[model samples]
Target: GAGVSQTPSNKVTEKGKYVELRCDPISGHTALYWYRQSLGQGPEFLIYFQGTGAADDSGLPNDRFFAVRPEGSVSTLKIQRTERGDSAVYLCASSPGLGLSGANVLTFGAGSRLTVL
Candidate 1:
């Protein structure tokens, strides 16, 4: 992919349904990240993958949220038993490396909008 790409762009679902969002990252990038952005806040990091392994997953709010990068190129985020509080834009980003001091710039996808009712 030239840049990160996410599917559906917008999804509307009833509360308690399961949904899967996909992300395709830039080619050759070694790092991928998932984030959730609420209405008025910045993107909060949910998980980070360096290659095929999850290097950090501390931002996932609960057991209902999970993500995977099976082959290190594309990833999916699955939400189980979704809540109204889960309505937000899910963002995906990729970088060459996890630079020190948070200096690395992530090229972000437009994002998948998940709306729970």
Candidate 2:
């Protein structure tokens, strides 16, 4: 896809289960980010990957959340021991690196809705 693409638009899982959400960013984009949005709340950054390495991951709530961009293009967000409170819409975004003016605009996907029962 020309834009960011996320798979399994919706997912329903039982508590204590694990889930993996996949994202494919636009070709040539070197910056990718993962975020989660709960009901009535804005999306919160989970991690940001520059190329094949994570540039920032301080937003991850805890060890239960993790993300990887192995090839610097496709990325995966992994959630372990899912809880009811963990249910939310996971969002993926990508940018073509910072502009000369230091502006970095992102293009976001439709998001992957996760529901824990």
Candidate 3:
């Protein structure tokens, strides 16, 4: 992919259902991040992966939320037992992960809009 790409631009589900959001990052980018944006707030970090391994996942609210980057290029965010409170736009971003510039330069996807009813 030339840029970060997220699937299911809009997803609406009832509470207690399971949901999965996918992200396809730019080719060769080794750093990927998952974020959540509520109705009126900036994006909040949920996880960061330096490669196939997750370097940080502290921002996840609980056990119900999980993400994985198998080949280091594509990622998936899984949410179990979804709740209305979980409604938000899930953002995916990727960077080069080469040096200091890697930490600052990010290409963001349009984001997956999750709406729990």
Candidate 4:
């Protein structure tokens, strides 16, 4: 896809269930990011992958939240023991490798909205 793509645009689940959200990035993009946006808040960074490895994941709130980019092009965010507070829009973004001169703008997907019941 020309832009990032996220699956399961809407998910409704019970608390304590496990959920996996998938993100397919634009081909050839080397940097991918996962973020969560709650009501009345901006997207909060969850993780960033440079190639297949996680370059930064300090944004993850707890051990239950995990993200992986195993092959560099595709990434997934996994939430274990979901809670009502976990409900939010999971956003995926990607960009060409960062340049030395300045910051890079990321291309974002529509995001997957999760609602915990």
TM-score for each predicted model, relative to the true structure: 0.95, 0.94, 0.95, 0.95
Q: Kindly list the per-residue Cα lDDT of model 1 for residues 1-117, writing each as its tens digit.
A: 788999979999999999999999999888999999999999999999999899999999999999999998899999999999999999999988776746567999999999999
lDDT (10s digit) by residue, model 3, range 1-117: 778899999999999999999999999989999999999999999999999999999999999999999988899999999999999999999988945753659889999999999
lDDT tens readout by residue for model 2, 1-117: 788999989999999999999999989989999999999999999999999999999999999999999998999999999999999999999998845545678999999999999
lDDT of 4 by residue, 4-116 (tens): 99998999999999999999999989999999999999999999999999999999999999998888899999999999999999999999885563556789999999999
The local distance difference test score of model 2 is 0.93
RMSD of each: 1.5, 1.4, 1.3, 1.3
On a 0 to 1 TM-score scale, where does candidate 4 land against the true structure?
0.95
- Which residue pairs collide, candidate 2? none
Model 4 misplaced stretches (Cα beyond 4 Å): 99-103
Tell me model 4's lDDT, rounded to 2 decimals: 0.93
Q: Tell me the number of clashing residue pairs for each predicted model.
A: 0, 0, 0, 0
Instruction: Give me the overall lDDT of model 3.
Output: 0.94
> CA lDDT, every prediction?
0.94, 0.93, 0.94, 0.93
